[model samples]
Target: MFNSLQDKLDKALQNIQGRGKISEINVAETVKEIRRALVDADVNFKVAKDLTKRVQDKALGQNVLTSITPGQLMTKIVHDELVDLMGGHQEGINLSAKPSIILIAGLQGSGKTTFSGKLANFLKKKKNKNPLLVACDVYRPAAIDQLKVLGSQIGVPVYTEQENLNPVQIAEHAIEHAKQNQQDVIIIDTAGRLAIDEQMMNEIRNVHQFVKPSETLFVVDSMTGQDAVNTAKSFNDVLDYNGVVLTKLDGDTRGGAALTIRTVVEKPIKFISTGEKMDTLEIFYPERMADRILGMGDVVSLVEKAQEQFDEEEAKKLHKKIAKNEFGFDDFLKQIQQIKKMGNMKDLLGMLPGVGKAIKDVDINDDAFKHIEAIIQSMTPEERRKPSLINISRKQRIAKGAGRKLEDINALMKQFEQMGKMMKMMQGPQGKQLMNMMSKGMPGMGGGFPGMGK
Candidate 1:
């Protein structure tokens, strides 16, 4: 994410970090570096200057206590200012109305249609709302089909009037359909229009007026940088949307749109779409974002993601298996699946405090478990249930079956044995002690990673 900006900010804070107290000279130098870093990240020059000035003033005004260093205080000040810069608190969608209407608007290629599907899934899963997705993009070819595909993926019904070219009429009809179907939420995916297109803009306005949505979100591609902010302003001027949605945020290393859009559009960032996955949508939290941008990680969000994919019953069963020394490749494969459901590998790792910077340059592929999965899948039922049965001949057979080298099988077997030993130890009387020791030695790594044992 904002890896470059985070590194720069860390360096900037280092200027006053080791100092006894905040001094004007050191504060000035640090603030200057901070401003440069912000500008380099594509943040608005004025916004960057205004934020750094506030940080400097706060730093100079503070009297450092013996408990905290100047660097810690300075980092705290900057984090707070950054939070304020991006909307101080999270803003949630208003779904109080019976079948609350949410209008999605944005420029073409802004991931509007995909976000609509994701939003529907989020509401269906998180908000416990029965959402009906209305595809209102009459102009774009296959736009309806695209929405239908997404709707099927999320198991949400998409209301589309293919024969009816009029979006307003389709939306009205979709509302009636939602009422009849007992749907409590209607997300109208409007056509993607350019700010300069008066006719298209007017069309979206008409739909907005007709629907009177409880939440009108303006989606923008965050990787567009300042242009995303400017486009948001243009849309806000016309529709005055309830909030903004930043899509493709995972690819945004500079984070200009996330930092500047709220201040420019005067709307809270309601959601952030990090990837193409329907479950990748997250409620925009300024504090959490500021934490991530400053290399502090977002442990809370990470835990939430894990919880979403966690199966309590399955955990209990796995614990029993571990205690019995019966944890096998099949159980390991299921764990990998659950982790994959949590989110992208790199993104999941980046949520740990101090891990983001460490893995900034590392390519932690989403399909990192591909080979392991293949190997596990190639094993017979007996082999999966009892990996100890896979002798040298079995290893060679499995290797050929999985299209892998014999050494790869050997490596996996060795690692799996080590993991089994660790699990057994953790399930024993000294489990808690072992966990504490591991945590102290490697914070955020109390549970060793899958396929990561030596």
Candidate 2:
């Protein structure tokens, strides 16, 4: 993430935050710091300068309201500028054609193959499109295999021609196959070279001309910093891509490409790929990204992720069980599974307003719930439904089966009991009041999840 840039921006904004009013001197100082922060993040110097200049102009011209501090005004100006620097709004893929073709292009090792799989998965799951993954990388045999593996993982059909060395022909054949199979979307994964070259460019250009894709995306590794933006510019000059895709955003990246690629290449960033997971692709939202960069977090995206995993009937059933005091280990396990489906635990926590900065140094393991899950799985069906039936002997057996210590089981039981009691309280008349108090005080609780001791 842009943790480093976020820290720098925070410190920069602090200069004008407590001031009584916005002044030319303070604005200049803050804008200078902001420029330096962008440069440090490896943003193109010209783009950085132009953006900060706009921010400074807006900051000085704005009238700080009685309710708003100088820092607040300045931050708003910068946020808006950043949003405009990226695309101001989200740009979706164009899939209106009967069989919309999306051509994926990028440098070698830029996660093009992986993103093609992810895009296919996203289209199948979210857009309700029957997508066919066409492996057009005739130069790399391994790429075709990788596409096949990913296609299998996502349950999408991958079209590959091991004997065919012409990508344009492969793509043309895949389209006919898609039409016959009733697939509505075709994502052709084109080949890439280590760096820009004439032969690679000619091959991809020929494929692009033959496919006439509804959308062409240029994928780049976000961790490459300024170099990523440069590569994007080179590609855009030739292909004039419809949009850009930033991959490997979860890496220890300075986030230069995400911040400046649109400005340099004049293309909207349509998608961002965080991890290798097929479900980890996100439609790019410039506003939410600005919020995250400013350490404001992305609550809307967090809620969207939660809603994707939410089942209305399941919730009603769980609520009924909790009201009857029947919530047990099985229900708890199901809740944990839903949370796991929401993506990485640390990333989910980072979506909270202030939690990202607070836990920047704290390692929140993705497997934080594994021990709890193991202990629950070790219980018998009856024990899972009625934990009260677990006597001391049963506890020892369950702990041994889970390869955990007896103390771990005891701690989990205590936490479960507390959670049950809390749920019961939530069902009562004073539930809202209790929740308010808990929201204010839970930060001081000084404990991790059940079985994860402080």
Best by lDDT: 2
lDDT tens per residue, model 1, 173-201: 99999999999999999898655488888
lDDT of 2 by residue, 152-238 (tens): 999999999999998988998999999999999999999999999999888888998888999999999999988888899888878
In model 1, the worst 10-residue window by lDDT is 445-454
Off by over 4 Å in 1: 18-22, 64-68, 433-454
TM-score of every model versus the real structure: 0.93, 0.93
Question: lDDT values of the candidates?
Answer: 0.89, 0.90
What are the clash counts of all predictions, listed in order?
A: 1, 0
Q: Model 2, residue 384: displacement in angstroms?
A: 0.9
Candidate 1 at residue 228, lDDT?
Answer: 87
